[model samples]
Target chain A: MTIKLDRPDERGRFGEFGGRFAPETLMPALEELETAFAEAWSDPEFRTEFSEILTTYIGRPTPLHPARSLSEHLGVEVLLKREDLAHTGAHKINNAIGQGLLARRMGKPRVIAETGAGQHGVATATAAAYFGLDCTVYMGEVDIERQALNVLRMEILGAEVVAVRTGAGTLKDAVSEAMRDWVRTVEDTHYVIGSVVGPHPFPWMVREFQRVIGEEVLGQMGDDLPDVVVACVGGGSNAMGIFHPLAERGIELVGIEAAGEGIDTGRHGASIGAGTPGVLHGSATYLLQDEQGRVREAHSISAGLDYPGVGPEHAYFHQTGLARYESVTDDEALEGVELLARTEGIIPALESAHAIAWVARERRRLEGRRVLVNLSGRGDKDVEEIGKRR
Target chain B: MGRERLSSLFARTRAEGRAVLLPYMTAGLPDPGTSLALFEAMAGAGADGFEVGIPYTDPLMDGPVIQQGSERAIEAGTSPDVALELVAAVVESTGLPVLVMTYANPILHRGVDEFVAVAAEAGADGVIVPDLPVEESGPLRRAADRHGLGVVQFVAPTSGTARIEAVAAADPCFVYAVAEMGVTGERAEAGGRLDGLVGRIRAVTDVPVVAGVGISTPSQAAAAARVADGVIVGSALVRRVLEADSPDAATSELAQAVADLAAAVR
Candidate 1:
């Protein structure tokens, strides 16, 4: 059976998962963005410029480091995809820079984004400053409190950080607020959605931007694919980025979700493993919603992983069994963070620590196998929160 | 019991050389009981129809006022069932056209067919789903058509000619002309390309055009009604209910507001 990896058909439906479910007011904007993205993505000059920016500014071709000590401890040959080394300390800058260039091409002077842990916000702020575009980022108030370092980074980068106080004061609320802002100012502004989520062109476009990770990995691995490729899933951008290119290569694609307390305890952010199919943030996808279809608040120690919905393409991957998804609780993720720090001298972001936790949890099965994990971001911003946990 | 549908309400108002006044109220806001009373007050005060907003957890198209009302309704445990029941009660009491206004998720949650069927059973004349654009509205539109419920589509200033024609081709009972480029909120005055959008819709289809979003004052409503077949005042009236100290105060204030709007539009 040939798997069609080229997704988001003309209507943006990835099978039954993705679609452009947004307001009428923003429909034209979305259409314009779709065209702009398509033309920019196809043009050789645009691609060359985007590649040059990634190489020079954002630091592309992030190294794949073999975690020898950690691998020995887990009884697996674990290699970490070093997105943490990228400028702004995460893989988020890749997409941010891509969208920033696209916004420039579209003649949009302002770029707006919604962020969870503030990595995406910081990355977007960095890109906006680099491109001389006005930038605004909406972050949930709760996240603003926890990720203060990142908030400062965004502010210092000359981006306005708006605290979204609605709906659990988290990533979901920030997404809602950003959409509201875009609806009003869409004429001159481009919404730089951080993850591979949201309406039609967004999920597809962001995935393409982030696809650099997987494409780089294919060449780096040198004819031997890792038995498993793992990344954390919070709106699932980094995971999708690393997974889309290597999906058909017979490697196991695994996504780790943040289980705040526990999935059974109903406080986790494991949208795919625990949620039902519903629409939120403009796409038909699995959502953490109540019986009445009201979206529920997702909880995670890592603010980046605290989202009620996953990317629509991730939902499609789950439905088609293209990838397997597992979850790690907050406590387990903290333990993963400590383990990586002690063994490999690397402090992974609490979000990426979920993938580390999954590797540790399934160490027995992964024994003697080469596993690749996306170290999506650094843990510097999370050091304070980690201290509180200790 | 005879109840008004969107068609008759618009026909009667158009025959009288005036536009209908439809005031939007968030169902189960404050509480279901108080919300029903507010609907009654608006109907008695001369609301030609009603837009009963079902409070979802996330109201993306709503401004601060309606967003707060929706959050309050959700906090009060207003489930889809509870909201639809309120719609039924409002229909029974008011005997006026009542359209269910919600985002796409709630209906998708119940399964479009089941939601449309239950809404029709609950006496909802139509539905206004802001997020379900014409492209993604096929299932909801088909389901509503099967249940004899009108699907209200929106036309915005940002929409190009092809998009407006597509919305008109959906054969909506009415075209909700977004008077401004923003979400539902009370502006100091109605602004944006309202005339352009309404005129474009008129050229494309005979679906009654009702201007909504940012119409706060009666003068604004009257100004919009001059071009649109109706005027939908949402945040202005919902803000009153949200800010009122007492239910009676909300009801009386809503009554006066609706009366003033009706006097202007009609």
Candidate 2:
């Protein structure tokens, strides 16, 4: 199936899946951001500055490591896009630095962000420090405790880490609180949304900022596009980043969602797989909600994948049959971490482990076919949680 | 009831030379029965209208007071259906203009047309979806117009002149001029943008402008009333009900607060 990367039409809609459903107070800010990003994205100077930062600061052009041992074990050519080697240890830095630069161009003096696993927070904090922009990262109290090291990294980078105690005290709540702050501070603050979520300009802007991942893969692979491209879907930045360029290439794009236990157990973050289309966090998308449309809290051992909502573009892809979505339970993701560590000496983040687990599970079916997986982040942050589980 | 109900409320309040007092309360809070009584009490205490919030799981525009109230209301079994029933109850008992305030998901989830139809059938004067701006509100506005239910529009301090004009063109029953930039909560001061925002909206349309958000005290409500056509006091009143010792105390305190606000605005 072919997926068109050109979406979120003028209204920022991916089919019927995305639109600006934000509060009126934020409407103008979103419009301003959309305009600024458009101008900046097109300007050669802005492009040069952003690319320069990615290469010089973020250590971009991260290698496409061919995991020969893992490929042999799984009976498929496993190519890993090592975003795990990027600055701040995740693909989140690409969007953060790009948005941080855009924020500076927009003349916004401060930036606010929301994080679940704290990767985005750390990345944003790093960008803020580099850009000399005041930064605040809203994280759920639960996530703050679990991802304690990232919290310290953010603080050390001079970003204030505010713990959100509302709702389930997780990523969903952090996004809500960051939005609340942005509502009031829109005059001087830019909300650097970590993923391809939220209202207009955000889903589109973030996807464009993160498209470097796919673009790099295009150059690195040199005409031999993998038969299937896989990445974990938690708000779906890394997945969208990698799958976007290869979407129309006729390669199978698979998104792995975190099914905390199992989909049938009513505890999972498999939004597109086991959710209904609904509005949450400022856009219409597939979200885990009850019959009453009250968003249900999603569970994932990976905090970054614990959100109930998926990106609107992913929802559109699922609807158009452009890509396939599957789920992996927490235990399966854990085993994936162990497998990758033992076979390739690479400890993958629990978020990326979900994607690896899917590849491992479908190894027999995927035998002899080349597969590309986005190792979205490093597992250093997950070592504590993994230690406890082991 | 339709936009005419809200228009006439503002007209009557204008004639009296007093700003329309609309007290906001979360439905099913402190129990469904007590909330109904509080609305009735506010109506008796000279409130011109009421904005009854349908308890939602994620009320991003709301701060802790209303958020906690919503959580409690939802915990006590206030589904959208039950909340609409409460709207009907408030209408039946108050005999005043009642607007249903909620986020967009609930309305969209139930189908915009169906939700507006049910709200109108339940005697709602208007609907305030804070998150649904004019750009994304086409379907909702069309459905609301079909059901003769007014879709309330919002103009924040951050709204540009063009945005205010667009909101004015939507023909809202009334324009909610956010008194401040932040979420719904009590504040030390109501910020200095109320007058300018009201002026901007008045320059474009004759829609009655109601200032809300952070207008907690009677003095702040009076300050906002002096600038806009109406004043919306939510978090402060919701907090009264939340902090009250008993149902009786909550009702009495809420009634007293409403009376003070009404007198100040008058």
Candidate 3:
């Protein structure tokens, strides 16, 4: 059966917010993604090969661990989808592997991608090494300074990292710089968008690739659909992936956005919850922009969640009420970070911590019910930031 | 005169065997107030029309020099409203036909109807959104007409016959025939294919055609004048303005560049 979860323009957004608003140079890439994904998603051979790689190479079918201590603390049965155990230590690798394979199949000689918190960059570089393709990653100058270890990891994996220094000097700028590179070398290059953001098929395609998280979680749960599935929404990739399959399962999918201080404080990355529809880096989505359309800076303690715009699908889902979005402040997310590390021995990425914080705070309402939280990535990359906060 | 009136002026110029001199500049670059002085200088230098570039974060079609000017404008806090105010100041001072040249995002951000109304209020005669092609210009065109603003359209050398026809049909002013496939900036040499492109666009429309993109020197302007009715100088003027010892000096140097090109085009 065809899945309506990944349909483009549903609620006219991804999740509730994603649409194509990209430069003309990337249109062909988006079109290719639409065609290839449509074909591969239907082909049993493609599915089998993809599943084989995920299971063997990426260590898929990660366990659904019942965090008894955390459940008791929160007064709800909180189950963690152990994505932290996945190859590369994050859910980012799933989409990266899929896009990397798609790039090779499309006969691209090089792969270019943008990364914000460096997780996606590391994941993409790993895929490039695995696929034996020349890879380059564009990262913001600030991100390189903050996430030096991941930058080194990307370089060690044989991917060249270019520092982008324009337009707030962050992920958006990296995306812009990547587009410039793609325009010059579109014939031989494939741009593997790191998240479920950007225009058109990317939001849909990346989510489909990530849906394995939800599929596996549901299978492992076995007749016990959770009351709510919580995932961090940094560009909404992990959230979309974990939520897409559960939409029809009669479970509430809550996407937690980063509220740097508080959403009301006007210093947050809660684009879907607070921003307006504006075009940035090519795709029109919910973005934080001034009255004149200049993109505003977004802030979050989690570098990964500090994006001003959200994926189109998230925008759609939010608009149509397919999913619910809530904001978690830096303090709350950090509290969640500390709680998870202490209780479950799994230090979650701050982006993921936002979702954990939401689950911890709201689990009282979900008493006597099961909750699945997508543990998006390990906290190794966020150690320095966490230490600084401490 | 309004943009439609300005288009008629160019049409009359074409009929009378006179070539238009379209000078381009980034609005509020260096400073918002100084842009007015530069406009006055260009008008004194005998520019027949002006293309005011609205500063944008990513100028995909701009060469290094024009790109720097756009960056400077943005640094100086030039927004769409600032650009419109500058254009109004120029039109109020010079009475020259002014076209707002910008990417589509700023226009979209400004709200199409409000943007057109603001440009018209600022005394802009027309607008040329380079990124918005003929196919996607319906809303902008309708808005421009509603506000009595002319919609200036571009025809690239690489465009096919169908594109040329589409551009001609939507264009309300002289067709801007890009001299090359790349962005606006300084080139070591003017393009080699202008004559063919101008001839091709001329075949598609009765409107006057002006060549832009790489026409930097007087000789390039003269070469462009061989087939087109006007030559637009953007990067050359912007470079002079950016390198001037001061904004005043930049205006003088830009005036000289405009005069040299105007003489060649004439």
* Candidate topping DockQ: 1
Write candidate 3's Cα lDDT for A120-173 as tens digits.
Answer: 999999999999999999998888887888999999999999997766668877
How does model 1 score on DockQ? 0.91
Worst 10 residues of 3 chain A by lDDT: A10-19
DockQ of each: 0.91, 0.86, 0.27
**Candidate that beats the other on DockQ, 1 or 2, i.e. the better one:** 1
lDDT of 2 by residue, A35-87 (tens): 99999999999999999999999899999999999998888889999999999
Candidate 1 stretches with Cα past 4 Å from truth are B1-4
TM-score of every model? 0.99, 0.99, 0.87
The superposed Cα distance between candidate 1 and the true structure at residue A268, in angstroms, equals: 0.5
Cα displacement (Å) at residue B129, model 3: 3.8
lDDT of each: 0.92, 0.92, 0.81
Tens digit of per-residue lDDT, candidate 1, span B171-217: 89999999998888987757558887788888888989999999989
For every candidate, the chain B TM-score is 0.97, 0.98, 0.95
Query: lDDT score, residue A140, model 3?
Result: 89
Candidate 3 Cα misplacement greater than 4 A, ranges: A1-6, A9-33, A40-45, B1-6, B9-23, B56-77, B103-106, B130-137, B150-240, B259-266
lDDT of 3 at B125: 86
